[model samples]
Target: MSEQPKTSAAPARLPGGNRRPAGGPPWANAGMPAEKSMTFWPSARRLIHRLRPYRMALLSVVALGVASVGLSVYVPKILGQATDIIFSGVIGRRLPTGSTQEQAVDGLRAAGNDNLADMLARMDVTPGAGVDFTALSTILAWAVVLFVLSSVLMWAQGWILAGVVQRSMYELRAEVEAKLHRLPLPYFDNQPRGELLSRVTNDIDNVAQTLQQTLSQLLTSLLTVIGVIVMMFWISPLLALIALIAVPLSMIVTQQIAKRSQKQFIAQWTHTGTLNAHIEEAFTGHELVKVFGRQKEVEATFAARNAALYDASFGAQFVSGIIMPSMFFIGNLSYVAVAVVGGLRITSGAMSLGDVQAFIQYSRQFTQPLTQVASMANLLQSGVASAERVFELLDAAEQSPEPAAREAAPTRGRVAFEGVDFRYQADTPLIEDLSLVAEPGQTVAIVGPTGAGKTTLVNLIMRFYELDGGRITLDGVDVTELRRDELRSKIGMVLQDAWLFGGTIRENIRYGRPDATEEEIRAAATATYVDRFVHSLPDGYDTVIDSEGGNVSAGEKQLITIARAFLADPALLILDEATSSVDTRTEVLVQQAMAALRTGRTSFVIAHRLSTIRDADLILVMEDGRIVEQGSHSQLLAAGGAYRRLYDAQFTSAAVDLDESGAAAVMAR
Candidate 1:
């Protein structure tokens, strides 16, 4: 197992007063934005660097490609030599013998020179003539040998390339995930989950898809075309000259098509990502759409996104569709030119009939590789676009600078925020001129109406965001000076909405401290009243949970979260609305477990409902990002300040509700 990157904020509040969202997490600052078009503008060397480690495999594939094209040169020669051999024998007035030479030549010589006797004599046993099997046989045997070798090497290349592409994609995604784990809380505040998902899943896939489908093919085609063209010129320079002229003409046409299609493909990919984001957002928030009756609007938005993708895809593919036909026409033109010119030369005795046949074959050969190379160009562009996205993710700024080792651990947990100020953006300060302190082993209960920056204070303690003014210290040391991982290991947290990753109940319970044994897990669970719930289930602690812990109730989720923190046993434990969502009975159970966990540890409890914070060593009442009033519950009530008013409102409402139900009970009696 890998050691997870520690986020700057220790396990503090989960960004909400209660479970899940306080509207959203706290996404205030985002680095580079994804470009609207998938037009990757990075140079070739950087793009191919993704494939760097697999150079040996790529080289092997290239060698095979050259060998495959090398076979092309031999086929024309084989046919040409066979034709030459037959014509030569007919001119010599003899038939070539398969079984030794002299007997057949003698039989041929017994007949007149016009009777094919001299043809046999020339084939073998003649003074200055012999069969020309060497050239024909060499061409045929090499063609077969090259065909088999090319297939084997290409297959091997495919397997090797797949591994390189897949592994790189996996590494890229895993690194991004690790960064997300380390990134500050503010980074997630206002961001959309669907947009992040696009970067990890869709964007990475695009990069890998480009490599797997198009890049290796392009390289292979390029090598093939180069090798075949060289051999074609070598065979007959005059015919090669005619065939080469058609290349530039054909290329000019392809270049125009390629440029247009490249733009189209870039737009198509961007629109595709947009389309995915819209669909993902709408589907994930189906309940919100239904409650708001925004179904029609969402549908309209989806349809428009879908239409844009379709138009872009059609345009790109359609533009590319013209390439093959154009190349085919060009190829045929070269063939016709070769045949007409070579035939006149052969008749004028300046060229052999065999040479004319060979030139025509070579002309077709030249276009086959060139046409494939041109057609693969669009696919090449798509791959480069994907690579750009991958590189962009790899190059994001670090969430926070790594802390140096000279700093010591904050032992006492005596946290103080002195005249502190914080802002996610320059113009908007969330917490302004705030000052507070939690002496070691002290319980600080933070209460507020809403948006009081209650949770923001928790963030400040962990140094998740830098203070704009003043400073916060932990045990006489500036919290920022300590390494983030070592700083967080000392703090434990229990949130209202606990995210249980897919794992067994026992595994979830020990998430905070993975080295915790079964005995420790059971003990922690018992303290949190989680073991009781676990025992009630058939599998007990062995039960598996999904990402949301769907098999368990909301109350059970909170218990498991508490149990997890209990096991970690940190110096500071933050209970950010852990019991805020539970029923009265479950809340009491969770509170008991919290009490056990809080012994010998400093705790920060951010709560609503007001009933639970009465026992806090200090109750800090906050409003509009500042602490308005704070004291013990009785003291605040006696003073009748902000805290007293809030307490009175809850008590009065509870009394009235009891009376209404009490009267109904009396009537039934």
Candidate 2:
């Protein structure tokens, strides 16, 4: 069974005597600020690196893009040739029948129309000939074939790229999951659950979408731009240069707009994570909010976060939205210039009418791709911003590595904390140079006030947190020398909150030991009083527990956890306020079951009720982080120290309550 991460120190008060919430520290709820602009390139580079494994697929996509774009670029030129055929036919038809082209040109020149004469001279036309219907039809059919081929190649490229992106995302998600396990408990303590979840779920999903939508299109657009530029230069260098002018202008516009929008995009996603955190917290504690009549406060907080998200999202989209229109406007300018220049070149006979027509089409192709690329800048920025978040999570500090040579599992549960010094914060000492030894088969009951390091003690025993100094040992073997899994395997823990996953009661009990037989499970249930309550239900042990375990009473949940621990039969057991949730009658039964379970095992019980620990083999009274008194319960009470005060404070109040209730009952009689 996997050991659960321990954040039991959540109940401990900080140095300033302020209580920290179970979820996280206060600063964790504060939204992250917008990232610096410089991170964009680094994050983009890292995202690109994630795709390195798919190089073969990407190369295939590139090849298909090139082939598709080459055909598409050449088709426009072919269509332009068809246009020339129709135009030349119209001019030749207007001339006298059986007249040669030379005669028509000379006639036009003699008529003082040199421009028309020059243009006609450049064309390959027969005098009095009409349109070449058959040739035009053939060129059109070839153009259609090229278009179809180009489309098929583009579709194939998209399919390959989509698969590559999904696979990359799949690997990325797995890495994040592994990273989460490797990260230390303090990392979770300092981070909001919803915020971390957003990076894993929402951000990764957005990255997948961004790559899916943009990768193939970006490749195609870039290839189309290159192909169009080559065709433009071939047809007319002067026109190509004019068209190239718009490239720099588009670049300038895109750069300026992107600079303004990048931070906004980062802010947008950051706020999304923050807002999700708030929503999660609010919903998770919705009962507390209603019971305390704090719904208005929750709503107000949600509205503030929601509004911040809206502002950031609107700013990002509005700024990036300017690129496509600006690109179109610039493209139109280049188009007009190319048109006028191409007309002049045709009139001067420097370029053929067919060539000029092709140049115009090339200009549109070039500008269209540029426009497409510019429009995709928003998605690219947003995706990279999300990538940065995921990378940050992946970069979190992980726990120290386990020793290469591991100690064997401890058979005798002799636990010792030697010269152990620990602090949640570096400067504030909690447990300092504390030494303790629990001999095998001893029930060490620890009694302490709230935030007196009760839960932290058990956590240290489980190796949940590393000590700043000193070592903890089990059966004369250092815990650090043992593999965490091997060490944790011999330990069973039941916390104040009885956690149960969504499953039947039988399955939950079986979770303690997957290999446990049905007889063992039922025996454990019977010992813990779970069998009594479970059998009363229609499904008995088969009754399904919801995610929240709402169907079972709080006391029943605690009993189920006790049964689980009993089934585990670990050599060492830690119960952190395990019986705190049950009522008086059930607590007695649970304590009886615990006594039977603790017979041969070493047990560490953290409790607030002095009555429960009165018969403990050893009772250690802790104040702050030190054990002020240690002895049997009666011995500590006789010493009349901290333990005596604590005992009096509890039993004295109980006696007074009993007397008051008795007098009230007498008056009623």
Candidate 3:
């Protein structure tokens, strides 16, 4: 048969099947910065690269937040102006910035100083400035308007901030998940499930949640601090100088907290995963715990893990919690000092009343952002830690993008392995330089003790694992050159475990062939003898299976799986005989179904009972990953080799009873 190269690609689908979901993208390389922990701070370029895609929206939000903060900074000035307008108009003199009306009135000796009374009259505003209230009223109205404006815009700014951060994190989560699907299978096998879950769910959530709180606050605070400092100098350079001294101290505190907390946060997340794993395991094995009477032991283990988690939590959060109150306390003290000293300057005639009032207000505006920065410090560290874990997983090596080619012309189902050697890792070959062939429509049986690489051979033929040394071909085409789905479509497997997903029976059967009709499903079920038992159930084909289908009998599950395989109509079938956990009654039904299904197909049967496979066209005996004997059962028996030894052991065990009629019929086939 000739092979035709088809170039059509599999359409990628997203997780949960809700959206046209692309799971995730590659965020970083897999093996860079091999540190003790997954937590890492991205470099400036990496951070910029992540932000580059959302630069436009981010810029707009930041600009709006700055405008909002800027609007708020001018609020106190109008209040000071109101105090001035009230005192001057009522007393007919400039109000003392502290007690202006009182101070100016005290300056006169009352007898010769009628000018002082005139000053006091000017300061009075009992009926209010009705006609001349234009400037003062306008200033007062503008102040109220600005306050309202800032509140509304700040709400809008927060909405935009949350939207940007959440959408960005969603994008990142998608990329990371995609990377997981494409990653080498060994990576998953090596990593813990809870840790992986933490990366996808918890870690990604942390980054997004923190970004909402921290990034916006950091930007607003930086702008606020800058604007406040500028205004402070404009108000009183000497007071601004005093505030600047406190700024450095704030920086010193923030830097120290950040450096210490970042490490603690990474450790905290890791411990969270460990603690989660512990609880999940304990709960899942509740029966085992009760049987073992190890409740105290489990409680102790949980306590130990919980204690570790708490230590990390306290260390990470305690440091972060300290930042806000410390900044605020120190900030308020500095503000008061600036107010007292600035007031003295104005009293001594070195500074104006307006200037001192503005300086105190400016002191507040400047320190506000600083206080925000200290508050947001923990979230910033947490976001960094979570981002690092996500990026690490996304950077793993993906499977080959191009798939192997399947022969277009229908196949004879002949499989040939030539000089095959394979190992999951670099060292310790599972199979060393093995060679074999299964002819079209022939039933080949492979038998071995555990760890003999019997299943490894099946995996290689299915292309689940790549051959280390040589090649495998179905018909005349190398399997490596076939499209993965196209190749898999031609082969059907009933694994030893008989995995049936949680769904209706029809759905599980249709998983192998989505286009399979209901009529076809029933016919396949009948062929496998599954129809007999299925129809007896209340729901028939529509019967629901729970997780692993625990309600159903194991043999019934295996029969349904076989029905599915039969429905798939693959040219080659792999049946691991332990699917029903083989016993006397189940063995007969499974064998009968398999006999009907294997009539015209090439089959690989992994049999636990040597008696079940005596009639195989070819029998391969394996031990320690190498074929020790190969031939038909009679031929092997006559030779009295490893096959003879195995047969003799079975005969001695008295556990196996071969049906002479069934054995003869299978051999004749």
For each candidate, the alpha-carbon lDDT, in order, equals 0.71, 0.87, 0.74
Model 1 over residues 89-193: C-alpha lDDT tens digits?
A: 454344344444565656655654333443334332333345556755775676677677767767776777788778877776787888788766654543345
TM-score order of candidates, best first? Answer: 2, 3, 1
Clashing residue pairs for model 2: none
lDDT ranking of the models: 2, 3, 1
Two-way TM-score contest, 1 vs 2, winner: 2
Q: Write the per-residue lDDT of candidate 2 for residues 146-236, one digit (tens) a residue.
A: 9999999999998899899999999999999999988877777666788889999999999999999988889889999999989988888
**Distance from true location, Cα of 449 in model 3, Å:** 0.9
Q: Model 3, range 164-251, lDDT digits (tens) per residue?
A: 7777777887888778867755465444566677778988788778777777777778887887777777667888899887788998
Per-candidate TM equals: 0.82, 0.94, 0.83
Off by over 4 Å in 1: 1-44, 86-139, 153-167, 283-298, 406-410, 653-669
Query: What are the runs in model 3 whose C-alpha is more than 4 Å off?
Result: 1-40, 43-48, 89-136, 288-297, 350-355, 400-409, 655-669
- Compared with the true structure, model 3 gives a TM-score of 0.83
Once all C-alphas are superposed, what RMSD does model 2 give against the true structure? Answer: 4.1
Instruction: Report the backbone clash tally of model 1.
Output: 11
Top candidate, metric lDDT: 2
